[model samples]
Target: MIIPKNIEELASYAEKGKNVFFFTADWCGDCSFIKPQMPEIEADFPQFNFIQVDRDQYIDVAAEWSIFGIPSFVVTNDGEELGRLVNKNRKTKEEISGFLKMVEG
Candidate 1:
């Protein structure tokens, strides 16, 4: 996953192609659990570019996207958002795969 340093870099990714923006924070336990499982998820969905955004590092960007929780995901294609899975709860690998499936559909 590409870790974007700022909003501009994040935007640049979506502008290039379809991408999944994963919002997370270092202090978030749920985010930590999901981190290791992301590689498999990425493998399953190779069509979409994955970008990891640290909410703490880019507070304003997270606010702009209305991502108030850790472990949130948003699918975007050329800067247009297609879907999202945003919540405060911990997510399983299955749930993450399901979200990608939804985006594929």
Candidate 2:
């Protein structure tokens, strides 16, 4: 997963191929819990480019995307939104994989 330096960089990524913006915060327990499984998730879904967005560092971007959750996901392709799993709940690896499967379809 790559971390965008700014909102513009994130937009550029979204405008290209498949992109999954993972919104998270260092202080968030949920984010930390799922951090280790991110590589596996990315490997499982090779079609999508994962971009890590720090909620604290990119608050403006999160606000624009209406993401108030610590650990959330927004999938986009060619600048169009495909799906999102945005919420303030803890997510498991299976749940995340399931969401990606649905998005892939």
Candidate 3:
């Protein structure tokens, strides 16, 4: 996964395909915990492209996307947001995968 700090950076990844996803902030406890587990999750789901963003660094971007919290996972295809999981205290590979599958499938 790569970290993109701004919308311009995100737009480039969007050109690649529908697998583009953005993870918001390091401050969210869930995101902090999820960080360590992401490598394994990436390994299991090799088809997706992931990007990390700081909520504070990109507040405008988050608002434009209607993100209301940190620990948000905005799954997008091309330029469309498929589905998002934003800090409901659920963080697990299985749980996240099920959410993505619901959107991507």
- Largest TM-score belongs to which candidate? 2
Q: In model 3, where do residues sit more than 4 Å from their true spots?
A: 88-90
Give the distance in Å from residue 52's predicted Cα in candidate 1 to where it truly belongs.
0.4
Query: Candidate 2, 9: how far from true, in Å?
Result: 1.5
Model 1 scores a C-alpha lDDT of 0.90
Better of 2 and 3 by lDDT: 2
RMSD of 3: 2.0
What is the per-residue lDDT of model 1 for residues 1-105, given as tens digits with 9 covering 90 to 100?
A: 999766778779967698999999999999999999999999989999999998988888889999978899999988888899998999999998998898888
What value of lDDT does candidate 3 attain over all alpha carbons? 0.72
TM-score each candidate. 0.94, 0.96, 0.82
Q: Candidate 3, residues 13-53: lDDT per residue as tens digits? A: 76666564555665577777777877877776677887777
**lDDT, each prediction:** 0.90, 0.93, 0.72
Off by over 4 Å in 2: none
Candidates by lDDT, descending order: 2, 1, 3
Model 2 Cα displacement at 73 (Å)? 0.3
- On lDDT, the candidate that comes out on top is 2
